[model samples]
Target: MIATTSLQRMIGALAALLAAVGSASAHPHVFAEARLDVVLSADHQSVKALRHLWRFDELFSSTVLMQFDKNSDLKLDDAELKDVADTIFSSLAEYDYFQLVTVDGKDVHMNAPSQVMTNFDNDQLIVLFESEPATPIKLAGTIDFGVYDPTFYTAIDFTEDANMAVEGLPSTCTRKVIRPDPDTAIAQNQKTLTDAFFNDPTGTDMSKIFATKLELTCKP
Candidate 1:
């Protein structure tokens, strides 16, 4: 990678973290633990935005640090972390920042991240961002808010250590995590997928079968 500027280095790092899978089928080339905070409108009748936190796996974190640690320091400094966050916020625009949102079976348009923050801890690279809906989604019927890599190059999972929460939700509302089992999802939906689906930069929405989702439902 011939990076002549700091911006180039940051972009290079983002590319490294987003390296595609080479498999004939979609497979994970990178991994991360994820958390989400779903914020509701002040009226509690609509969704405002989804705040995300993703802590990348050790191997990919090291690869990212290698690209951004320009000062020869062993660890990522505050400035380096900020650059990394900026890279993610910009580069991931095409990926919808890995967020998939829907209401009553209708797709919810998500705007680009409004803010980004980064932290490096215990040899991991963590990114935080908030993405707002193009328009507030009314609290009606079922809502599916999820995190997935459309290309399946990165497997973002929600583990017990992390949480998926809804803030300012109406007392009548309920929320649940819809974390799918990969093996089961593959068996059920792999037939609908093709090489083109896995390789396409702007792929179809076939990744929902294996996503870690937050399901929010409100009573009529």
Candidate 2:
């Protein structure tokens, strides 16, 4: 079940906090706008790292600020921000930092980030982290990458195509952000999706239908 996932436990707390503030949603209680940097090695032969930036929705941001603003000064000081970052870093590690990467139809293993950074911008809480592939991801064929909460407890969306970019992709490569239709995704996964999951996806993966990923095609 999703509740069993360590990441979900923290999400549940955030959901409860949002609910208390009257801002909770149906499935994804938390929402964030995401940007991804697909970094490739100097030779463009393998992926170097993935850098992510997530700016949370206002309601959830405020809820988080309230919790982390230990001094109750309506400001997240550096220390407080680090506290927030630490909390999130610990929680997200078990979920692969909410990142999924594939190369030529094979899964790419990613190591846990060394640390996460937090920033408060325009009344929203922002999180930044970078993950390195455990093994070299050669640019042999199709490479896909996306960030999302599989349990659907958090809605992480790339607001625009421009938000996804390749830092060092060679001119020979082609990449695009493919947005999937939620309805279509749900329909295609009908057999796998149970009614209980729709009612409460605390244990099931809901990412296939919701993840907007960057698909890269390269001939090497």
lDDT leader: 2
Give the 10-residue window scoring lowest on summed lDDT in candidate 2. Answer: 1-10
TM-score of each: 0.82, 0.85
**Top TM-score model:** 2
lDDT of 1 by residue, 107-178 (tens): 889998777888888999888888899988888789999887765567888886238888777877788887
Tell me the lDDT of model 1 at 125. Answer: 85
Off by over 4 Å in 2: 1-26, 195-201
- Residue 57 error for model 2, in Å? 0.9
Q: How well does model 2 score by local distance difference test?
A: 0.78
Q: Against the unseen true structure, what C-alpha lDDT does each candidate score? A: 0.75, 0.78
Q: Roughly what TM-score does model 2 have, to 2 decimal places?
A: 0.85
Model 2, 57-101: lDDT tens digits are 998788777776778899999998888888888777767889889
Measured with C-alpha atoms, the lDDT of residue 109 in candidate 2 is 92
C-alpha root-mean-square deviation, candidate 2 = 4.6
